[model samples]
Target: MNKFPNKIFDIVQEDLMAVEKELYSIIQSPVNLVNDISVHLVQAGGKRLRPALYLLCARGGNPDPSSELLPMAVAIELIHMATLVHDDVIDNADTRRGRPTANARWGNHSSVLTGDYLWAKAFSAIATGAKQNMLKILTDVISNMCEGEIIQLQEAFNAEQDEADYRLRVAQKTADFIAASCELGALTGGMDNRDVMQVREYGYAIGMAFQITDDILDITASAEQLGKPVGNDLRQGIVTLPAIYALKTSTHREELRRIIVNQNMSNDDVRRGLEILYETDAVEYSYTQVSKYLQHARNSLPITLNGPVREALLSIADFVGLRKY
Candidate 1:
């Protein structure tokens, strides 16, 4: 198969410079320490997809893009980055986006502090200028995000977890920000409630697909490609979709059971469990499920959107599930 860096990748490359500058402009800080830590992570590079989603949704509503969209973009990214840094600490991960994780580079204390700072900045941006309704939406979104993460932690290694539970977890953890980002963008576009809700649903579907694909790739993608070992979720005692499906069909269900339920599995035991997962079609099955969501996302797009900007957002939903990075 051809690699993922093609036309859609080119679109992101073309827009990245403007997006980067916009992010830099709003994330400024008088506190040198906070600025230093926050800038380090920001500069490290992310796909900028969350912020881009905001911009794209704005463009879709009105053909003209706005500089006013900058702070919102920056705010969304700051919130996203903060969550990631905190997640690395929670996961005890060493790398992100193929670079050393903030937690790894700056120690847990700095990582946590920096993450908190980002959260504060993101909230401040929303409270200061954005519409009150948008701010309220974001506040609720962040709270839901925290709830999702906590739920994931609670369900970790609970192999009895079902697909519905998996979908709910991802909806709360990953889809909320995505949905909010699109809604904020549409609001910025000056769209009415109905249009905003439709776009938000589109974003939510994309986010759900994105997270499900992520879970599948955690089992199927290689370390060089993933920036960490496959099965990182399993290592952290989180049983993802593949594991859940695999265990159902696993001939060695008892072995898998002992490891997941009892806890404290050796690295070798986890490795063997992963092998069993691969041997089954669990990864393939999950990918099939993700594809269905992606299709739903595409179908959910409003017919009103018809141009390069809308196409770009659609391309992104198509890209995320299949991309190597």
Candidate 2:
């Protein structure tokens, strides 16, 4: 995949290739329908950022986290892919990564089953001699993710959903999962409990920044850059950080709120909403939030974290802060 280049990826390029191999193996099955759908899911590209984060954290303390820890990275990525697939169904998304979504090509029923299978495979991989402590991390993230999704459903299209409300959903839906990936990686890397917690905190900050950046890009980025249409989240009635800021501060609050709350967004409505967002400091405010969290992620690292691993973590923060796609 053609993700933005970074120094951190070079550090784990070989390990990342191994992860891709294992992921391909897991997507295979006896059923032709399952196999075809799984292949499509694989073809729908992703940068595999979650697994790369895991491998980097594992390398932080350990001298060498060998093939033994490879499965953990694969498992983490599987869970991530599962969520994206299921989310497409929920959103009725036609395309992802510039290609037809699984639910679009096949059907929602098959797509949902494939997503369920991915979740099962994730747990199965974790069960393969993984410690209970590691398993607990996965289970906790899953629980939090479910809670976040439920809250998102309850809050969708409600213009009253404030910054605090948006953050609550973000903490559980996205940040929590990234935290689990880091924590699990550090645990496998044989770090002490104290260090693992610190790494998890770093992941938490970066996760928030990464997700918030995604929200900003949804509005400010072009369709060519994002591989999808702009203002998609707003059209779906999912009020994002920038939109929330605009709603609270912009003079056109009533018009914006009407479009969002009514949930009947046309191309013209989307254009009008974008006009309001740009008139305010919503995008700039969102950028400030992303920068703040990235700085926090950097500060969370202990003094002892150094060498190639430390540089990698720092580079990840920079990438998250500056990436356009």
Candidate 3:
């Protein structure tokens, strides 16, 4: 019942609630620890944007829920959840969505295994009835995500990274899964091949914009809004779009370099770094890039695709552009 920025969610409120139930049902494990950790992660809460997008696409063909869509939706969400738990372990993050992370509460060992269990469960859900192609898509997404994380680890604090490097990383780390979600949704929705391609492109563009906006918010939004520490990426030496732009454009490039390379920046240093980023207008520059991708996302949608679902998709696109958290 929580208000979402995208009106489409409100329109599909009942279906999303169903997805929430399915998510819980699918992740139930016989192992008490696995069940406890997975349940805690689910309770932590996320927008469920990935599954929502899937359901929207599926509804286009099968307005009344199909057996195929629910399992796919559950699988997508579980994959996303697995990433979050593992990401927390990698970052040594203590909190997520304003709750203690699995790693934080259960220790890294348990958390890693819990994350693995989630991954296994995700694939199991998919294997139940999904097509071979769908399995291939999911496998490729997992590979890309791992490669993205490895690339990010390799590039940490490397201020020399360019837009291409960032884009590739974003595509692997975030956009591919979103693209897969839309593609699979369209496929399940009985959309034609061309239309499915269009939706997939739209998902990819929006996914890029989503991550760029998230990176911007990491520097601009408060910790409470983020449900994680502000400037956490910078603190961890994970240079994002704003930092990349600031490195290229800011007058304080040398200072930024020193702080970033040291990788042990103090709070005051982060404050000053943010100031430099602001002065350099890196945030606004990133926003411009987000706008470019948003434009692409809109253009990718077929003009012939009309009605509430189409409108909802457009609305979600706009929401991505304007979202703060």
Candidate 4:
């Protein structure tokens, strides 16, 4: 963000800070354990990308949207936080953003309940003032996220998973929520239906690109860079785009399939799988997909949008397609 679009955030840094302050205030709980656990998770920190994207889109439609849109922005973040908490539990993931996850620090029962608490709070915060349409978007996205997770679990270590399958999971698990964030932000900012739809698709494109880039990084990046084990997705038996591509194009296709289906993958299996990915140019192929989505994101931006906000959106799209972390 510092390199890509810090200036935009710099202009609204106070808004983001206010979000953090307000978030901390919301996480306060009567139960000591609840407070401690939720606070610990919040303090672990995140990209805050959902809220940031929400704010940017809100600002694009209304210059002074921060005061009015604060609740929705915070709700978006809360939902994101809730989803991550649940995801860590589902994946049994130990770390997120280089720190122990809530599921790692607390037991699954505690973490799951805490995630439910967050989700309830998120809806409670928005249910009072937000429009019916906005409420529907959040509810739908939450359902989609759950469905996506279920699909991923069912397809674990599925070497037969194709590009279509990969895309379906990406759309449900990641892209749809991102699109909703932008749309909700635009609605909060007072954009018309047409413009809102444009930005919605824009967010969808970037969201897809972002997840693909993440999956690419999973295989190609280091644990230190990722703040978790490299190849974590593969290690979890989650097949992504690069692996799916390699399974088709690699000369060692059968070997790659063998590695993917192997429930107990050794270090050698992971290494060999990566070799097939690189050897088949699967990484580069995945990059091409990122580029395509990014281009669509740019194309989908509202034509009437001009000036810094538009530029900020473009910069973010670029960052999503090219980020190292």
Best by TM-score: 2
Tens-digit lDDT track of model 2 for 96-213: 8878899999999999999999999888777776788788889889888988987887788999988998887898999989988888888887888888899999999999998999
Candidate 3, backbone clash total: 0
RMSD of each: 2.7, 1.5, 1.9, 1.8
Between candidates 1 and 3, the one scoring higher on TM-score is 3
Higher-ranked by lDDT: 1 or 2: 2
Whole-model lDDT, candidate 4?
0.87
Report clash pairs, candidate 3: none
Locate the minimum summed-lDDT window of 10 residues in model 3. Answer: 1-10
Model 1 — TM-score against the truth?
Answer: 0.91
**Predicted candidate 3 versus true structure: per-residue lDDT over 1-325, tens digit per residue:** 1235646676567877887898789888788988899899888878888888888877755533546577788889999999999999999998877778899899999999988888888888878789888788889988999999999999987888888999999999999889999888888887888988998998999899999999999999888888888888888888999999999988889999887877778998888878888898899999999999999998998665678878888888888888888
Rate residue 31 of model 4 by lDDT: 97
List lDDT for all candidates, in order: 0.79, 0.87, 0.86, 0.87
Clashes of 1: 0
Worst 10 residues of 4 by lDDT: 1-10
What local lDDT score does residue 273 receive in model 1, on the 0 to 100 scale?
81
Number of the candidate with higher TM-score, 2 or 4: 2
lDDT of candidate 3 vs native? 0.86
Per-residue CA lDDT of candidate 1, range 1-325, in tens? 1234445545335445566776676667787766777778888776677887887788677633434666677788889988998999998999876778877887999889889888887777666568778888888999999999999999887878887888898999998789899989888887777888888998998898888888877877788788877778887778788888878888877787667765677788778888888788897898888888888888877777777867777788778767654
